[model samples]
Target: YYQEEFAIRRTLISCLDWCDILRIWDVDALL
Candidate 1:
């Protein structure tokens, strides 16, 4: 559900530093 996704995104943002977040997106683009 949308709420579940929002919670997951919030947790991910809290857990990862900004640079780590960019790295994750970069890796996803590579895949």
Candidate 2:
């Protein structure tokens, strides 16, 4: 159970990180 929760949390964090990276790229492209 604990391992499953940890995996979910890690996946969520990576998804958020990817979003942030994409946002930054979008801003850079606009500039």
Using TM-score as the measure, the top candidate is 2
In model 1, the runs with Cα more than 4 Å from the true position are 17-31
Would you give me the overall lDDT of model 1?
0.90
> What would the TM-scores of all predictions be?
0.50, 0.96
The numbered model that scores best in lDDT is 2
Candidate 1: which pairs clash? none
Candidate 2: count the clashes. 0
The all-Cα superposition gives candidate 2 an RMSD in Å to the true structure of: 0.3
